[model samples]
Every structure is written in C-alpha cells, then in structure tokens.
Target: MIGYMYILQCSDGSYYTGSTKDLERRLQQHQSGDGANHTKKRQPVTLVYYEKYDRIDTAFYREKQVQGWSRAKKEVLIRGEVDELHRLSECQNDTHWLERYSSAFGCAQASNIIKKERKKDN
Candidate 1:
C-alpha cells in the first residue's frame, strides 16, 4: 500500500504537514473538520503538495522533516522549487551528501508543475 505525506496551505496562510495511508480520505477529513486540532480551527485548507511513499515510516519521517522546516523552507517545498529546495537542504559548510536523499526525490518536478498551473490561473 502507498502511504503519503502531504502539505496543506490553510486559509490563514499557515501550512500543515502530515502523513496518512489514505490520502484522499484524510484530505476529506481535514476539509470536514475531522482532522487535527491545528487544522480544525484553520478550517478550509487547500492541498498544496504531497509525496507518496512505499513505506509508512518513510512517509512519517518525511512529514516530520517538513514539519520542522521554517516557513520559507516549507514554501520551497510547496512550490516545488527544486533549485531552492536543494540549496536549503545543502550543508552550509563543506560537506557532501547533506542533501543527497532529498535531492534524489522527484519533489522538484511536482512542484514545478504546480507552479506553472498556478501561474496560468493568475
């Protein structure tokens, strides 16, 4: 089964990150106010980004990683700004492989697609 990590951009301009086995159902719950407390008050969030994982642990860990990020970092993730995301993931000092895992993911691609559509909308 595919587990997923998702990010929601709430009406208040805040972001929520979470992992769930059922992406569609989980999103429904969030929209229906059956989601977490943070989201319940925010009411009416829009799904901005998501990543599917083969393992639940992977999805959970990714959700945590995103949750710990600063708002700008999360925006980079949400916008699918691959170049910026890689820069953010890189080590400030000289160190290889700091962003290896993150860079390998296709998040950048998805982000880019979303970015374009949003541009067309505007």
Candidate 2:
C-alpha cells in the first residue's frame, strides 16, 4: 500500500509530524479532533508538507527522522530547499549547526547563515 509522511502546522504555530496510509482520511480525522492527542488539542491544523513512499514502514521511518529535526531544518524541507539541508545539517561535536547557531546568536542570525549559504550556492 502507498503511505505518506506529513507535517501539519497547528493553530498554535507549532508543527505536528505524522504518517498515514490514507492522507485524506487522516487529515479529516485530525480536523475532527479524532487524531493524535497533540493534534486533538491543536485542532484545525493545515497540511504543510508531505512525502510519499512505496511502503508504510518507509513513510513511518521518514516521519521519525523528520520528528527529530529542528524547526529550521523542517522549514528547509518544507520550502523544498534541498540544497540548504546539507548546509544546515552540518554537525560538530554531535551538535547540529542550527542548534548551535540558534543558541549562540538567535534564529535571526541563523536565518542570516541560511541566506549566506544560499548566496554561496548561487
């Protein structure tokens, strides 16, 4: 069966990641507050991103991988900035660049880094 890994932008401006075999039905469930507990509390979520996979397990695995990602990384994926992913994922001492950059300066500074990287790519 086909499967899909998805991301939802919640009413609270937070993100919720999930996987489903039936995207439409699952989205309806979430909208009706019959979804995950997290989505239940943050109803009326908008589907922000998704990836289709050949197997449900593959989609589930991808969901798990994305769930561990920082918001910046997820945003890059959501925006389809595939090139930025490697730049943002650069790690040192087991700490992701975004995590370190964010803690060091701030999200705005991190955004600057992304911009700089984009310029370099171009």
Candidate 3:
C-alpha cells in the first residue's frame, strides 16, 4: 500500500523524520504526545515536509535515509533545493578514490597514471 515519509519541526526547532501508512493519524499521535519518545519529549511539532511512496518499505527507507542526514542536507530537502542535495550529501572530510589520487597530481594526470597502472597489471 502507499505510504508517506514525513519530517516534522519540533517546538525545540529540531527535526523528526518518520514513515507511516496513515499520515494524518501518525501526525495526530505526534501532536498528542503519544508518538515516538523523541517527538513526545519535543512536543508540538509542525509538519515541515513529506514525500509519498508507492510502497510502505520505500517510505520507510526514505525516512531512515532522511533521519541520518545532516541538518543542512535536510534543510536543502525542505527548501526543495534538489540541485544542492548532491553537493550537500558529500562528507567534508571523506575522500573518494579519484579525489585521493588526484590530490597529489592534478585530476587529469592522476587519471592517466591510474590508466597506465591498470594496463601494466593486465
């Protein structure tokens, strides 16, 4: 069945992300202090954003993903800044393989070196 992934802005200004088959009922529960402990403790939350999904699992998955996101990334989603999501998704200190190799030699030169290494191995 269809389900919803939703984000709520708590009275404390924190965000809560969750998924449910019944958005209205779930929201009511949160407002009434009968929801998850996190929301119950931070009562009086306002629905900030939501996305509908064809499958309950999909909604749940999205909710988990959103819950793990940083505040800035979440804000990007709330503001409907789709283009900024990718850039925001990147971890500041984490480096990709290409980035690590390219840091010493420029990107184009690093790429050529990697290609040469691969050819040598083959």
Alpha-carbon shift of residue 12 in model 1 (angstroms): 0.5
Candidate whose TM-score is highest: 3
Candidate 3 global lDDT: 0.91
Clashing residue pairs found in predicted model 2 = none
Q: For residues 8-103, what per-residue lDDT tens digits would candidate 3 score against the true structure?
A: 999999999999999999999999999999999998999999999999999999999999999999999999999899888765442464687799
Model 2: per-residue Cα lDDT over 1-122, one tens digit each: 89999999999989999999999999999999999999999978999999999999999999999999999999999999999998888774323656777888898897688668769979
Worst 10 residues of 3 by lDDT: 89-98
lDDT of 2: 0.91
**Model 1, residue pairs in steric clash:** 80-111
Worst 10 residues of 1 by lDDT: 93-102
Query: lDDT, candidate 3, residue 14?
Result: 95
Runs in model 3 lying further than 4 Å from the true structure: 97-122
Per-prediction TM-score:
0.72, 0.75, 0.78
Residue-pair clashes, model 3:
0
RMSD in order of candidates: 12.8, 9.5, 8.0
Clashes of 1: 1
